[model samples]
Target: MTVGASVKQTLANLKGAQGTLRTYSIKVQDESARSIYAEALMTTNKVIDDLNKRLKTIELEEPQYRAY
Candidate 1:
């Protein structure tokens, strides 16, 4: 679809990935593996936040993309 819809979908996918990483972090027994998952989860969270800000900017700059 449209750019807005595509970005929203990508955001959703990233959130899903974050959830999976969190679950893995909780379940894994190895200390190094847990640390790696935690780091990945943190990075994913940062990307999600940045993407959310970008989405807001996009909505503001392109009115047609708002609320979708």
Candidate 2:
């Protein structure tokens, strides 16, 4: 319900989704397709990491207010 809790939940959800996508990519990528899959996975992971970092930064930078 709180902003901090919401941010934490969102980060956790992103991480979970990232892990699922990574597993699926690895399982589906063939010998010849591995390179493409790896590239996509890397890009996706980087974005997820960036998002999580931003969420944390916001959580830290913003002052918590009393919930009415």
Candidate 3:
């Protein structure tokens, strides 16, 4: 696929993951579940980092297609 499409998909995936993380955070907060919260936070952070790296690579390759 093209760089733009790839970047869009990656960003969508990252947003979905962020939503999931937020949900998990709320759940953990309400239930006072530290273990689950920590796990979710770690996973969320990793996904975010990967997404950022991929986005940077895409931007470097195609500087004209900026993501909002």
lDDT of 2 by residue, 2-68 (tens): 7666766776786777677677667874766666667777876787788767766766677573222
Winning model by lDDT:
1
Residue-wise C-alpha lDDT for candidate 1, range 1-68, written one tens digit per residue: 76777888899999998998999999999999999999999899899999999888877888886664
What are the models' TM-scores? 0.92, 0.54, 0.54
Q: Model 1, which residues run further than 4 Å from truth? A: none
Native-referenced Cα lDDT, model 3:
0.74
lDDT for 1 (candidate 1)? 72
Local distance difference test values of all predictions, in order: 0.90, 0.69, 0.74
lDDT sort, best first: 1, 3, 2
CA-only RMSD, every prediction:
1.0, 4.2, 3.3
**lDDT for position 42 in model 2:** 85
User: Which pairs of residues clash in candidate 3, taking residues 3 or more apart in a chain or in different chains?
Assistant: none
lDDT score, candidate 3, position 41 = 74
User: Which of 1 and 2 is the better model by TM-score?
Assistant: 1
Candidate number achieving the greatest TM-score relative to the actual structure: 1
